[model samples]
Target: MGDRWHVEVDRSVCIGSAQCTHLAPAAFRLDAAMQSHAREPEGEADEKVLEAAEGCPVEAITITLVGSGEAVFPPEE
Candidate 1:
């Protein structure tokens, strides 16, 4: 829990891999439509959230720090 993070799953890009859920169950879950949804944005550790984002093969997960709106996982470079 390094900082408050906002985790967003791009439904258009999510391919039902459920990798995010496996990496950080508390932060993500698949809906009935098989789209990944952010369950508890604050439930998982910051590192886990980052891992979930990095593990997404489709790169659907986008994590931003609260207040600052800084993209932490993707590394906007």
Candidate 2:
């Protein structure tokens, strides 16, 4: 998983909707703070990860290439 993408959730922006957890259970988990976190971004496929992020109501999840630090989800508009 060294070369795979990484996921991060902005705690301030997250609203504990649990949508990401529901969409990609293997990759996401609810933390003690009741925020969604990416347990293993590679646990699911790229598309699945993307889908989970897309379903986040607060748009708190952020996906990026591990080495490049480039944003993969919530892409610039």
Candidate 3:
């Protein structure tokens, strides 16, 4: 199995601006009801995921390394 990343969003904090969708379309999607949700990135593009999280106005997105269970936000910067 591919190494996975766990993505969580505090929907209450999300303003539905869809910035994450635009920044990392491969890692995020909006459902038919327009609810934002996470999808796995197509390889080691954790940076893209991090960008989406940072781009979120409300900071609703949180990314965790699946195997290590470590937070990937604030992205090593």
Best by TM-score: 1
lDDT of 1 at 39: 88
Candidate 3 off by > 4 Å: 1-4, 41-45, 74-77
lDDT of 1 at 15: 97
lDDT of 3 by residue, 1-77 (tens): 55567788777777788999999898888877666788753236377787899999888888777768777774655
lDDT scores of the candidates, listed in order? 0.83, 0.81, 0.77
Estimate the lDDT of model 2.
0.81
lDDT of 1 at 30: 92
Off by over 4 Å in 1: 42-45
Candidate 2 error regions (>4 Å): 1-3, 41-45
lDDT of 1 by residue, 1-77 (tens): 35687888889999999998999887788999988998865433477778889999999988888878887878889
What is model 1's C-alpha RMSD?
1.9
Clashing pairs in 2: none
Between 1 and 2, whose TM-score is larger? Answer: 1
User: Native-vs-model 3 lDDT?
Assistant: 0.77
